[model samples]
Target: MHELKISIITVCYNAESTIERCIQSVINQYYSNIEYIIIDGGSSDATTGIIDRYKGQIQRVVSEPDKGMYDAMNKGIAMATGQVVGMLNADDVFTDNSVAGTIAAAFAENGNDILYADLNYLKPNGNVLRKWRSGQYRTGMFNKGWMPPHPTFYCKRSLYDRFGIYSLDFGTAADYELMLRFIHVKKASVFYLARVVVNMNTGGVSNNSYLGRIKVLFLDLKAMYKHDVQLPPIALLYKRLSKIRQFF
Candidate 1:
């Protein structure tokens, strides 16, 4: 195994209730070469205090204000010093202790700069609510509105140097935009690690309310137009309807 140093970033704001669980998951990773960084959005809650409990395990922690989640992620990316970088939300976690090991092995097997996999949506009681299985990436998949879950997405630091990081202007669609730009436009080499990798909690900001969803749709349309990703009106309807299958 290539013992690649992997940096996992957890961006949070006022996540006192779940930040510790997220931190524990990272600290207990079976892999040895792990760098954990936490970026706080000047949370008024006890989030930073909770993070302080694991200061020894965490390599770095930056607590300050930011424009939004994507901006906070940008800061974390700038601080990353590992060959591979991935994000673990404050409310989500690796599916197992060897998750990092599995990721390292996949990157070692092929010269794939980008790696992503399936994810499980968890209920508050720790039960699986839904499964997001991201199949292999094929050419032109983005046009059909296919996107890998951001929490399970990992890529070499060099790709960011070559392309770029999350765009603040894209808002909730920033993750979608970045993936489209990388996989479809720039044609970065990628691999799909066909297994559940992270357990993402529900109630993410973008899906919290009807208004949020509407905003996401507008931003997504903007991104698709800018990248020249053809999203036919019928295809857009199918895209929204397809998510229903992820649920039970």
Candidate 2:
């Protein structure tokens, strides 16, 4: 697995409080040969300072203005130079040091183009609120509203080289679009490791408000439509209700 280089990118903007833990999680991984890249969206806070503190550990650090969260992610994707590339938001982190090592071994064992796993959603105070069970990847599941949490998702660089970068058009659902385009539309081989890969803090951009939730459903419908998947509004409704079941 060491032969395959994995590049993990973290996109940050005013994430000073959590960036340190995020960086340390990657740097302290048991698996060697990870290309860690950090893209900062011109943070006015101490984000840059925290990044500089661990500059020696990261392969590359870019602090510049970007369009939005998705745009910053695209910039990092362009800079990635590893066999497989993945993103972990500044506020989120892997479940453990060996998560990356586990992912690498899955790819080496299966030779799949994409890999992902389950994730735990935690509160800002570090309380576990829910477990997002990303059931194994299966073609046509997008119509059923089955998606791997974008943070826990990892894909080969070639997949992006062929399908293009995350589309800024979808806004919060851009990661959803890219995953669908690559895995469902392009039919890329995907492997789902049945384990928790990341621990993401619950209050992210998509769940920040009522309107945000509506926007996610709208864009998700558009993404499904573009690929000829044809998901009805009820599917989104069912998916939402099914997700709520995880909180219990």
Off by over 4 Å in 1: none
Q: Write the per-residue lDDT of candidate 2 for residues 1-248, one digit (tens) a residue.
A: 24789999999999988999999999999999799999999999999999999989999999999999999988888999999999999998888999888998999999999998898899878888999888877777877777788898899998888889989999998988898898888999999889988889888999999999999999988887788775556556666777886797
What TM value does model 2 have?
Answer: 0.97
Candidate 1: how many backbone clashes?
A: 0
The TM-scores, one per candidate, come to 0.97, 0.97
Give me the candidate number with maximum lDDT. 1
RMSD of each: 1.2, 1.2
lDDT of 1 at 206: 92
Error of 1 at 35 (Å): 0.9
After superposing candidate 2 on the true structure, give the runs of residues whose Cα lies further than 4 Å from its correct spot.
none
What does the lDDT read for residue 14 in candidate 2? Answer: 97
lDDT of 1 by residue, 1-248 (tens): 54799999999999999999999999998899999999999999999999999999999999999999999999999999999999999999888998999998899888798999999998888888988988988998778878899999999988888999998889998998898888889999999999998999999989999999999888888888888877545445666776888995
Output the lDDT of residue 18, model 2: 93
